[model samples]
Target: MGCGPSQARVLSQAPISSNPDEFFPYQGSGPWHTSRADSVMQPRLAKSGPASSEDCPPVTLQELLKKAAEEKGDKLALKVERPCPSLGSDGGAPPAFPDEEWKAWTYREYYDESRQAARGFMKLGFEAFDTLAIWGFNTPEWLLSALAAGFAGGKVGGLYPTDTPETAAFKIVHSGASVVVIEDKAKLERLIPALAQRGEATTRIKAFVAYGFEPEAQQSVEVKGSAKPVLSWSQLMTMGKEAKDSVTESSADPLELRLKAVEPGHCAVLVYTSGTTGEPKAVMLSHDCMVFETRTVLNLARAHMGLCAQAEQERVLSYLPLSHVAGAMVDICFPFVATATTPAWVTIYCARPYDLKVGSLGDRLRIARPTIFLGVPLVWEKVADKLRAIGAANSGLKKKLGNWAKSKGLKNSKARLMGGDGAAPFAYGLANKVILSKVKAKLGLDCVKFGATGAAPIRVDTLQYFGSLGITINEVYGMSESCAACTVSTDQAHLWGSCGFQLPGVEVKAFKVDPADISKKEECPRAPSMDDLGEEYQGELCFRGRSIMMGYLGQPDLGADHVREIERKTAETIDTEGWLHSGDKGMITKHGMVKITGRYKELIIGAGGENIAPVPIEDHIKACCDGVNEVMMIGDKRKYNVALITLKAVGANGETPGTDQLDAGARRINPNVSKISEALRDDVWIQEVTAAVKSANENGKVCPNNAFKIQKFMILPTNFSEEQGFLTPTKKLKRPIVENAFKKQIDMMYSSSETYVRYED
Candidate 1:
């Protein structure tokens, strides 16, 4: 997402609305209100900055859509490659990428569709302030449902497509949603049974709408307790159109009235946290919060890329899970914000659900060729691996030339990070022209002007790998609570490992705290007059900005106990003073960049009473060893820390772990035995990994003290997969789950004194 057309303001203080709730009258016990409403959603101005939330032209998603429709009516807003069942073989999966039919929707058409959907929702018994929970993959229907829910004056939430039937039902029940949108008939069938099993939760549902299916594919799936049949996408649209036409000119349309009643301070979206530690909490984000974040992110684009002013259209690929804040912001909010508030407009291309995987994504990228790209660390790693395999196939002189160019590109990239914009070598231009440009073109990233990586910590090797090929992957840091806009790395300002500087108008500080008692804050950690790389100020990173979430969703009507629990959870993250304490431990550099160290909760305390952050140490090992795909430290109560390592392998579907075949780079090391199961017994493979671990331990950059070094290591038979519940949907390692699953292997490594231990078959 890029900045809009608003001029940069030079105000000393953030613009604050005197009466925040003046626009919307408070309704009693509704989905729009969260626990601690009096304090949670209060308007908080930035301590100091030029950007202000009030500067955003539109206050709500509905308003933003309307503005875009009025101004950019003829501009392409969305594009989708619809799967063709006719071209499928034997009633299996849809047609291949080449045979898929593409469709485009203009800004005006997008708005109209949303408006009609909103009317249909009202016709289906949806009321003002009701919740609409969308459970689907990233598609045109998902976006439309979310917008329509907002347009109909309702709070919108999403359930990850990866969520199980139970998890989906839990979110629907928790949100008190009157309607749920499923991607297709099969998923709808699975969900209806789960909802029916829930005694009270099932009663809340009024309708189940299914999209991405033909009318004939829509089955008579119904909850056991109820007789309501599943509504098809076309049926919903027809209902909406009839409702719209029924409204005479003399009478006010109910949908229009709902839209008019929408307010800036009202809750617009509910973003659920990953819930790694406990049950997921629904984070309440106000319309004001979303608008502010959209503007701030866009402003950064204007500052760095000079976007909005340009005539060229920004092309963005919408592939990430729409349930996540990062995904929703980039794909949904960013485009609308750009269209409404800035001269720049974005055309979004919807990707298939499986497009996040390594092999399948390339086909979609070739079609979309997005100008803006953002991916999680795993996504970036896959792309790097794909490129590596391609390079490994080149022979003789071509290989030599490619390696030479990569060296120059890598050097120039590193220099650029050190503020060496004009320090490129004489041969750098030639390298870009002769090799790097062609590589980017082949990968369909030639059109990408801006690229970023977030969600989890990325490997330095992955960054350098992309840098070597003339692509800079800027790291961004934010969570659901911050509306996914806090700090970002841009071309103008960036650090090697840091998450980059704080966004304009977003204030960030490192507050001092006791490691044993993180809640006991003492004072602000100060970074005095220091050098360029000085990181003297180390503490918990806290953020304060308009983009901060309102509060976690609370069921006030449920009981006093439920309300108290919600308040307790909300208070743990946000303080009375309004600083949202990110559980992450990091520091502010003298240069004002934010560098994350590790999670406070994830810190490992060894038996020797030394506290250590495992992420850096684990990342170091992965960086030193190209074959390793995952690493976990296991010495929370042991004498020394040990690592559980899994080698990269060829996937059956570019996602799930399948064959025992070792990945390309790993196979090169032990060509005699390509399978991981056999490679563990190979002397060459074992020795290489042992040497890599030793190098990682001796690297002071990651392991500052001797205790932090991994004393021993064990190789797992398989990589962590989502199917095994070892990895989250976003591809982050589930530390507790992994530890529990591999307890026996971890125990064996500690019991043995060998430097390299093998997992028992």
Candidate 2:
């Protein structure tokens, strides 16, 4: 019932379908004929269609880790770079082997360490189903802590390092976590005070474990009025070693007994939603949910990127926060799953922060040169902007050559989008040999065969812009509720501006809703056929699959009525039929690819009675306007759409400055043109953004009714960020929070007598 090697015998017995007519009926037609616009209409399903449960049995994380260690004992599992204080003096000599700072760990070593950590948790009295909350950036220790918790038969909840004290405390308290693992002293400082404030509510928390403590700095943090013991990483490990040695063969191993008690249906992790529309909720993902997602991703990689070969070496860079589902899948699960299947896969954990001033990501990428890369849209956008800025700074001839190569690459990319083999034109191949290849090598993407962008809607222009530079970033769509397993663009069948096809064993459909309906309880009619899909078939995207979450965690003791309400709402979301109602609005194309439009609750109903999705309008504005870092269309229930724009800080030369330079400028406290807020006051920058918005409206890329033909826009003094509670951890705008925070600004846009910026200037 397993896949790949485990199902080799079954697959060999099955007859392979080789009929050209069955695979590609219109082979004689040109590539453009295969586009979604003209392709045959079919139900939205996986490339191989729906798979039975028996075909892919669910496996637990502990089992997966154990199998990987047993199979790939000697293979490289992790690579982490640590500062070697012994090698060099901070004030004096440079260290030898500066480039060889990485500490390597094999699968066997990782397994042994994780097992020891599990025993340590047992010693700390962590029982089955007990919550173990981890807060940290991407590090080997973070991964080990998560796996160790799983091994100890406890569910793990991740807390983002950027979370404020109050927010972290809420998650920890809500998840009922008894053990909290902090990354370092900086995180501990923020969390300890919050935990102390909780008083009796946090009494269940038995211990606090902190890692990465500096040995030279002999400092101890005392939690005021709290008698709970706080243990260091080394102390916990020592306790585990002692405890393991004391155990006899006659006595049952506590860790082993707990592992045997684990079930596929048991909650493995509790991932909090981004809370874009409302307050965050804990999504309970079962062991089967994670296993299904991991297996589907691995299968997709093999089918799309040819990553299944035993000899092929796959490298992944873990940089994103493990608290997020996308980060957890890419940085933790993907590598572990791949290692279990093949020994050639390697994961590089990125601990160093990238300096925006010098653009260190490019430098790191050059070193890792990962074969598979996944990043949020912001990461990709920043890289794109950096590359464009570097190109603009180049001398006349070099800039011209680079621009020429980019144009050729764009042409090749467009052809590939239309289903043609991505072989570049003769001139393009020559240009790539002369310029593009070197550019890719310098950016450390020369070996990258697969690149993906998700977490938020990215501008099609941004995708094409990267493609023009020889990096085709495939857009993916998913949320934490689905265990980050949903639709994805593949090499075999993909379309520009689409999230691609559904994964195997997954079912997706659009539920058509009337725009005029404002009631929360309104149920839309199911569009079952192509004839029923009206203009703009976009509606609330719903799916049923093995990967959907069990349900949101409910507080049963709140009240009978409240508990009943929670159960009713949960039933409405997941339904009796097993379909999870995704709050996202999307449509399935004729080719079975899904195109996400916007969030259902975030849609704006204009005063003119036209329905508008803000994402397309915002994306269009950002693509047209270089000065704008973020644009939120805020005209809900208004006559026309007006935007709240946040401009990037400009330098002396009027160009957008890097974040580092801006931070330094702010620290100087000089009454000069250093701050982003000060830069926004410039008339020239205002006019630039105004003109960009006008151009975007005139171009009309989005639907006519939902166009960016806004009446007015107000420039905000500061950018929306997670620290300010205006943005989620994943960088998505918290619509309700932002709207409430800027209520005055929004009212002013409508009530003010100022003339709207026009296209005629």
Candidate 3:
């Protein structure tokens, strides 16, 4: 796990800032500097191994919550908001001003509520290690129920709200969850049909818990043929209270007994991967894995930002779907751990409570002003697009001033990359004080010191553009199996287009693969030594560490057989040696930074035997056109690569609207416009797309043999979406699904008599 000699050399040559605080391992005494064992937190396990005391802390969610309640009982732990009907309601309609109320819970109250829910589970005959499925948004109740399951020594699995009834039922049945906590009556109603469809397969589920509605409201809701009873949140709590009251002080509390029995290696959570190629596999993460990831992330953040006493002042916005590992870690695990160990941190849930304008993240940012912001590339892309559009719409002096400010910002960013502090230039002070400040305020990024992007590869130009604005976005790399813990770019050492160094306690290596071996599945080479590292060493990225998951549920021996089965279905694997073969073709730089090139399974092999990585081509095309949203390169065993492009639908104001808004508007314009391909017949959109592709082909970097120059392309009528099953929940393109869905369109491009419509360099 130690850094290689080359890595050491690279680190030694990195620039040292005059202000040491601005550099790595910021020279400041912080909470993390204190002995972790003495932080008044202890592992929940009764016994620890020799190395466990010093390295792996046997911590669990139950322990983290209990410690937080003990340390900061009266402090605000959560703020749940809900929209309410008006007092003088017109048939229970929403208020004129849209009335809303906030429900604040102290740490002790939250803990007590969790215990009550745990007691309720016990009354319903639930036992330790049982699975409880949670299906909802990032609500306070969702957190409470998840914690309750943990308190009862049960594992919790979350389902994406966007998942169809069939998909949700499949997970519920597959995970063997006996209880399901749903968002509301509507969500419960949606599940019933799927349950009936599933028949006996869903018989394992004994009960359904509903929230976001009154007890009377839940009583009216019914499942046609389900033997299980549906209960309201309050009813569950009431049941828990009654159960707790009946227990004598002489008897050990059921919740306490469950907590005591908890072990670090026990599966605490099941995060199902967004099964793009096939059925989703439930990734079983240990309590220790989650705790380790939290601590490691905290340590890195503190070192990079010099955050000593400011840990308490940090705030994070929880808006991403909690089903994803990134969302669960950020919104649940990080805050819980921080609250236990630091002076108190706040987590703000940004769902229905604030009457947040759908697709208007700008408004949410302004209000939250979170110190730490995490987003997928798509979110950042939209922000950049909006800023660019606003600047383009400006006229005369305003436009000139805006351009000057941007130029100065870009200059400052470049200066920082060359080892200077990212300070605004003297000539740019007026712009920073006026235009930039206003813009930051509007975007609610004024307080942001650490920004991160992950789940998908973002365009390098997009990252550079944000850096020019003085917001350095660290591109993080991880997967569901790692508990979303892997490489992360930091303020201390970051390179453009790289996913930075491996996380502490984590080890990564790249292996060489023969380009001609199409049948050979991507695997960890026998000799994965760093001595073999070179330009030609680029292959599959493999990682192993404490933060890695125990294994996928139901798959005990993750041997070659298991790996081969997974590859057969999804073209991904985790070898028996414990290294996760990421299937992602990548290379580790001398500096230890990892750069992902493309997916091995998704790589295009042309008829001429050229192996082309599609990602670079797609990114280049995207950089060249504002009108294009996504590009799927198609040329597997074909003469040359062609692309299926999805156009960005523009609003009446001449700016491309958000996907949701655009889809709605398109439906109104013409119902058939549901797919982006249908709208590709537009002459203007066609011209813009063709020009973008041509420009990419001319300017894009490519290997001698692996030329990514697109000979032809057809614009698609529809954009890929999670709802359409063409994308993962995290917004990554599902290659197999996309190809299958657009097979006819792909076939048309190859069969049509379109000649070499290529642009000359």
Per-candidate TM-scores read 0.91, 0.84, 0.83
Tens digits of per-residue lDDT, candidate 2, 259-351, equal: 887876677787888777655677777777787777777776665566544554577777777888987787777777777765355555463
Over 4 Å off in model 2, which ranges?
Answer: 1-54, 84-99, 214-226, 353-359, 513-536, 555-568, 650-683, 703-708, 755-761
* Clashes by residue pair, model 2: none
The TM-score of candidate 1 is 0.91
Question: Could you tell me the TM-score of candidate 2?
Answer: 0.84
In model 3, the worst 10-residue window by lDDT is: 1-10
lDDT of 1 by residue, 1-761 (tens): 33222222222222223343322222242222245422335444433343433454337888888999999989888888765233235323343355135788999999999999998888877887778899988888899999999888888889988888888887888787888888867777788778776666466678878887653544455554565556888999999999988999899879878988888877888888875667788888888788878787777767665556575578888888889998888898888888887777888888777655435666667677777789899888878876787788899999999999999989877776734553677799899999998888778787776788998889878888998887878888988999995888776665668787776666677887655544567544545322222334667888866677888888654568887899777777776556678888787755566778778778898777766888878887777677777888988877898998888888723246546888857766767878889878788888888887888789886777788899999888888877676777777778898888888888898899798998894
Scored by Cα lDDT, where does model 1 land? 0.76
Best by TM-score: 1
Residue 446, candidate 1: Cα error in Å is 1.0
- lDDT (10s digit) by residue, model 3, range 692-736: 777777763543343568878876544667667677877788888
Candidate 2: lDDT over CA atoms? 0.67
Total clashes in model 2, counting residue pairs 3 or more apart in sequence or in different chains: 0
Compute the lDDT of residue 311 as modeled in candidate 2. Answer: 52
